[model samples]
Target chain A: MKHAVSHIIPNLTTLTASQTLFDMVPLFREIYAFRDLLWILVGKNIKIRYKRSALGFLWTFLNPVFMIIIYSIFLKILLSFDARDPLFLQRLVTGILVWQFLAMCVGDSLHAVLGNASLVKKTSFPRIILPLSTVLANFVNFAITLPILVVFLFVNGTTLGDMWLLPLVIASQFALCLGVSLILSCMNVFFRDTEHLMSAVMLAWFFLSPIIYPFSKIPEAFQRLALLNPMCGIVTAYRTAFLGTDLMAPRLVVISLLMSWLILALGVSLFQRWQVNFGDKL
Target chain B: MTTPAPIIDVRNVSKRFSLQQQRGETTIKAIVVDALRGHGKRRDFWALRDVNVAVQQGETVGIIGSNGAGKSTLLSLISQTSQPTSGTITTRGKVSSLLELGAGFHPDLTGRENVFLYGAIMGLSHRQMAERFDQIVAFAELAEWIDEPVKHYSSGMYVRLAFSVAVEVDPDILIIDEVLAVGDASFQRKCIARIDAFKQAGKTLLVVSHDLNTVHTISDQLILMEKGQIIATGDPDAVVAQYQWLSRETACTAETKEWGTGAVKIKAARFLDAEGQEAEELQRGMPVRIEIGYEASRRIDAPVFGFSIQTTSGILVYGNNTQIEEFDLPFIEGKGTITLDFSALELLAGAYLFSFSVHSQDHQTNYHRLDNGHPITVRSERRYEGVCHMPVRWSVGKGK
Candidate 1:
């Protein structure tokens, strides 16, 4: 026997298993309601990454500085890459920082969902928050270290050209990282081989993107194909904004922005599919 | 029909978990292998059947069954972690499962920090958790250790703090699996009291426990399942009773039937269902037997062996002895099992105690007596609210 229920049905909190996603409205709302959870996870990432170390939070600033020093020596001194160029160290610093932010997000995401298997298997929070938190954590770290970049720029005496375009490019790179992170994180959940494969992929991807080398160095015929990487456009835009290198055409940056969001949309849909059985996979 | 919309409505939902997925095998190898094999060869194990249940806004639904009965799977489905392979589950408001107690907890974080982080995972904003922070700390009784990292806390302390943080989130719909069974006895009692208050406040609840008595006493409706299929779901008493009987037929899992003393000490006792097979439970209005095993130290004269079924509260439902039944008992010795058969037991659906005794016929001496205090579960299909089900019919004649 059932009673004639008189309760009103409010919108937005209803969930149907048949289609948990694809309709982004409620997904966005769920994510919004759990924004506090997202922030906490991001905080956890930032804190736990350097826990138990003597130079804990200092590592965030020191890490990039050291990488810049090591790679500059390995590249310009050892490999003699554009050794005569006076501003080569500045270029390397700016390029490495941009690359490191993206790398942290996508790289961390490989373990984002897998490492938190307990969370994924037990609770039903917005799962995107996992990969998204990695992206945000790296973003926050990057934001906190902007002063380091600014300090470097001032020390080098280089004028930041079309400085406003910097935020747009940074935002573009965040989207690219988030999209790829989602894909890699979900893939890693079902296939541990993705971890090995992702490391290899990220290694190759580092070279594929123009972090140390200028984008113009790529053969002229391949430049059009390289723009499709999204990161190429991003890295180029960042160097152009900071070092005042020939600013990559506005149209190319626009193409990368569109590509970034498109990949993000693809990531969301694929994540929905992969995540359906995440508890089992994890 | 004005059917009041239940806050949680699960309709014909089923979930199939892939074996390959559990083994961490992914698409790339499977894709290439499947192409070479000329077909899809992956296997899926169905974890749930067509389970359909609806719970009104304030109803408490208790799920009980043996291991691998898909109880947790159903909870996960309703809680929104794992999606169903087929069918739809719709729930209103936030559904937080205690199954994920302390989920996302970092061992390096202090107990206080873990609380907010754990709270945040359950949908509590930092400000909201901060508002309840002091209360949570006091409830966990971990004030001294709150600032210490969770890794330093004992496992019991970890669970205590986690349970405290979860209770404070106070979602509209709560899912708990063996949560009340956690912590020490005193902590468990505290959790039960808190859960009772939550039930009193009219929150929709789905609770799962192997402890049948607790679930039976607390739930309005009970679900019994076997092999991912619902065997029964209805009034708590009747469903619980049926689960006992069904479990007897399915598995040999029964309580080592509890307290008694005497010369004719009831070494052990068992109940037989209508089919005359040993079971942990008996069906109401069905023929059953209570078999008592005893080992007498020496020969006893004119000993009266008897049994009494009483309400758990000590009210007598029925009692019978060999002398009362006009059977004269001779001297008894050695180990043996004696059975008392009932054509049909009419007790209502509730736990009742069985008291077995053997004494001198004149009541002058006691040879042996065993009141194991093991409550026998009598299941019923009808919802008769009392200690016994009376055979009565209503007639609407003029004389009536």
Candidate 2:
């Protein structure tokens, strides 16, 4: 009788399990494997962006600062808005900060696929990580701007009652931005016109999200429309968390969470659909 | 050793590529409209179709083909870089494909980092990579440059590091596709030695190479592919012989018009050995015979037959015939044959060509000449150096 040889070495395919969550093993494995590459990719983008800029990291701080000044002059003073209203400027700045984070996330991610086309064509890896890493790097910018936001609030003589909620609000804002960035970056692969379309979309999204004007200023029917937009609830949550309870709406928070998950599911599925064909088309 | 079951069983695999030359917005829209109308506006090319192959454990198989014959495409399918459109590929080992040098390498990262990065992509554990880290660098000969960014390295350095990491990661099945050609000759020798070591250790290897020497040196089996299908597969020597015959015939037909005259066309030619038999195999320094058959348009006088032997790289190794030596024979125009016998085929182990030309004995141009002539298959029983195999013997003794 001929004896069969047992396989001592496992195949890459065998290691991949049938369960969906098991796929995360390779994702996490690859993350750990290419950690150095990830760090270098993020580091290089940051260094090249601010390399010779006179202000360096202060430029990160200056973006929101400039926006706050412009908003104060045009929306607060020139327009004769009520500054004395509880956390009025704070509420406005919360919206602006979220908008700034959104701006950085979407703007950087729009070029993620185009910028790394060489890597995509030559090497095989999870290409989603390229755009996701861009989002993670921009998160550093958001984290850096937090102290500035805190100092401004302190100078305005505001007191914190439920400060722990700020992290939750920021986390939700991140989820929202990530969901949108994922969708846009994948779309940019098929349609080269998506980058330009993103600029126009961001411009339109800015006005629709109550960044320049409060949600309350809009008509009742329009407010319902605004509430339907996930950014509306996230921005409102940020305002309520920082402003110490002027308009804390938990119902919209629940709605926003659901909306974020929906966007994430849609974004992930869309990305996965194109990923199998990416190596060929790219 | 043949295993009970092949570790990789590829069945009826085929990949069709519909490549669009233009991808601008307007072009894409036009294609979409055309697709909607049940028409494909893109040019379709079959990269591979109905290719069946199986690789058993501890077997080293070499895939040989001409350019665009889908050798790399087959490797890609096995490595899962791309999927086949029409077949199933079931593999049972941990496959690590060195598809391109430094394939997953980040230019901005240091070599140390890129190693770990590529390791993770290959599904190696971090600790496993860390354990092999020093060995990888030592093999790559980049101890000093390991901390430096890979972007600063030369192309050879890049391939060395990449190949080192790939081999060090302890893969069960390895797929190498022409990456050895990227390095210098010395590095190529080193890579070949590494591959030999891997085979010695009982690893399965699938190699695609245009270098027939390497294929002959290392491959236990050879797969000959043509036009996206496997034309032959079996013993390395036999498959190589088939590949040579096909290549020679193809080369002969391609330049047929330039070499043969319409007046008296040389239809085919064959080479034979001393026993007066059609020879498919010949040893170095052995007598061989050449037979040329022609269909004539008109009768000619004092016609002489000439043949030249050439190395595969197109260097004329030896040429002389009755025409050049002033020997002549009469030929009728309708149909005839000629035979010439050489005492010994003084050639090395490689494919050699024998082309024939017919001319008048007086050195004037003749009515019929076949310059592409016929190709003779040559193989030396003993591996010899240089263009022609010189007869020699050696003895091991103290220097006298």
Best by DockQ: 1
Q: lDDT of all predictions, in order shown? A: 0.77, 0.72
Residue B301 of candidate 1: its Cα lDDT?
A: 74
Q: Lowest-scoring 10 consecutive residues by lDDT in candidate 2 chain A?
A: A1-10
Candidate 2 CAPRI grade: acceptable
Give TM-score values for chain A, per-prediction: 0.89, 0.84
RMSD of each: 8.7, 5.7
**Candidate 1: how many backbone clashes?**
6
Q: Candidate 2, residues B366-399: lDDT per residue as tens digits?
A: 6556654456667766665566866678999999
Report residue B32 deviation for candidate 2 (angstroms). 3.4
Instruction: Judge candidate 2 at residue A40 and give its lDDT.
Output: 52
